[model samples]
Target: MVNCVVKNWQGEAVGETTLDLPVAKEENAAHIVHRALVRQLANARQGTASTKTRAEVRGGGRKPWRQKGTGRARAGSIRSPLWRGGGVIFGPKPRDYSQKMNRKERRLALRTAFNSRIEDLVVVQDFAAELTSPKTKDLVTALARWDVTLEKRVLLITHEPHETLYLSGRNIANLTMILATNLNIHDLLTVSKIVATDAAIAKIQEVYCD
Candidate 1:
């Protein structure tokens, strides 16, 4: 078990919480989570874009000219790749980007990500820092008080999207916000550190626990 210090709104350490490392240390947690999130992100890709191939393009079925009659070079179809406005060759086609992963695998991946956060000993704090208005300066100032600067990418996880917080952090190049329920492996792997709300941590435990 490892102790995670929790802080209050004023950036003060209010208490400490213990987390079981075993749950986070499953054999392939990282791999599973990475796979799951990769699948999810892949699915989110816009694969609907499609282009016409020579065979699929209109006005391409007939030979452009007689094979031996004209002085012009032989041409198979008007839509040939060599012709202007011709169909594309080996172009992109519409497809479903979604891939499936087992429910257990998804859960494990999520647990692994959470465990990674714990291992990193990311900071968890109360939600009292919610801003009434969107102001990047205020949010930066708040984090500065905790000795967290804008130099590194920070992931701010909350129970839900707080407009004020969202707006405040939107202007800062190094800060990003994400909802707890939508947590993903990339965010965990890429961010310099995580700043999660207490409620978000509880929700994570509830969702990942076996």
Candidate 2:
């Protein structure tokens, strides 16, 4: 459980909010969170990198020189790994990099990781209504009011997608916006600061606190 001060668009503390998601035990918290983080990153890889081996390289069937009596090192196939334009030796091949974890354990890890970042979390009122237009300047000012700076990587979690809010924040290079329902371990842990709307917090609790 955590207690957070809720601020308005002007950065005034108008109220407070609490987060009470179930998390892993302290003894296993770090391990579970590490596993979850690794799984998320690994699953994101495309695993499309591939290379040809000596046996797979074209024109490797013919030997370039005899096994002995050559002035230079006795060369075999022109596609030898030691030569240029040759097949790779023990190179990577395309394959799946995804990792799997139990659903309950993954959720527990997420809860633990999120709870660990309480100190860096900032809760704010739903300010989508405050933005009359898709102005990045307005969003920047509001973020400044919330003590977020352009130098830091920020994660903005909202209850749902708001067109105006999205437009306002899309241009901020360091800002990442995501829905509470789609929360994942990577964004939650990588950001320097987390700015979540009060409604988003409620949504997180509803979706994750089982």
Candidate 3:
């Protein structure tokens, strides 16, 4: 097991803890990580974009001009693709972009993500970082102490919802709060650093560790 420090809200290391080797460590799989990332991005698409086909466009019922004999080229409906306000020939329609990965693959991808960010992962003991009020500046100070710039994206994970923490992160555009239960490979790879509390780490191991 790899040992990592548990830091206080002031960013001082108060103690150390061991990462559950099987859950937090893994053999790197770049391809699998890419695939999982793609799947996640694709799934996030609303896929609600739609366009009118020639058949669906109104005012297309009447033929615009005679089929032949006129100096002008033979014409069909004004809604033809060649004309202005014409319907799209082929366009996006409502669809489901969601993709699925097997359970084993998902677990592997998450573990790989954890391993990739091992150096950037920090575990904070619950009491050391507990917040009773929602203060964005306080959160910023805490992060600055850890060398995690507020300009860069940071993922803050907790075992359970903490009202102050959630609200504090709301004002910080670059900071995001997520529950350990909702943790996925996408956020892990998207952020520059991860700050997870001891409770959150325990929760993640409980859920992901075999």
Candidate 4:
């Protein structure tokens, strides 16, 4: 168990909480975290890219010229890949980019990500909308009070989705807010620090520690 100072919306140290690191035989926490992050990022992609092939191109019905007799090269349709403004020869087509890892591997990856963040973890006593609106400015100010700068990518994990908290950090480029239920490997590795609410920590323990 590790004791960490818990801060409030004002960025003041309001209390402290104990967090337990999951015990596992895996020693390469960094590698696990990286794998988890890769998997999550892969899943996020829509993989909707598509391209038209030469056969799909329009205006290729007629041959440009006779197959023979003419001095010109034997020609196919004007929309052939050899012609200008033709369809792609071997372009990418719409497909899924989602990669699947086994449940055990996914869990391991998440555990590794959590371990990586442990070094830079910051706990918040609670997320009270009354104290701060879901504005980037408010989040920035609070982080500043805690001496956490915008230079480092920050992940704000909570037990549940807090509209104010999510809205506040939505505009921030490097700051990401997510609920514990949605926690994935990709977001965990991308962020430099983890700022978790007390409830979130408990939830993580409940899900991963057991």
lDDT scores in order = 0.75, 0.92, 0.81, 0.77
RMSD in angstroms, all models? 2.7, 1.5, 2.2, 2.7
Q: Model 3, which residues run further than 4 Å from truth?
A: 21-28, 127-129
* Per-residue lDDT of 164 in model 2: 95
- Could you tally the backbone clashes for each prediction? 1, 0, 0, 4
lDDT of 1 by residue, 1-210 (tens): 567788766678888876652343556665676787788799789898899988777887877789997899999988888899899987889888899887767777766776767644445575545677777777888777655766888888888767777777888898878887887777777877678777787777766666
Look at candidate 4 and give me any clashing residue pairs: 37-185, 37-186, 134-168, 135-168
How would you encode candidate 2's per-residue C-alpha lDDT over 1-210 as one tens digit per residue? Answer: 778999999999999999998988899999999999999999999999999998888887788878877777887789999989899988999999999999999889888989989999999999989999899999999999999887979999999899999998899999999999889999988899999999999999998877
Candidate 4 per-residue lDDT over residues 1-210, each given as its tens digit: 778888887778888888776643566766656666777778888888888888888788887788889888887878778888788988988888887777777776677667767778888877655446556776788777766777979888888767777777788987888887778767776777788888888888788764
Instruction: Return the lDDT, model 3, position 48.
Output: 96
Candidate 1 displacement at residue 69 in angstroms: 4.7
Candidate closest to the true structure, highest TM-score: 2
TM-score of each: 0.82, 0.94, 0.91, 0.83
Off by over 4 Å in 1: 21-27, 60-62, 69-73, 119-121, 129-134
Candidate 3, residues 1-210: lDDT per residue as tens digits? Answer: 678899887779898877763542334588787788898899899999999988888888888778877889877899988889998988988999999988777877787778678898978877425677888888888888877886788999888877787777798988888888898888898898899888888887788776
Model 2 segments more than 4 A misplaced? 66-73
Q: Poorest 10 consecutive residues of model 4 by lDDT?
A: 127-136
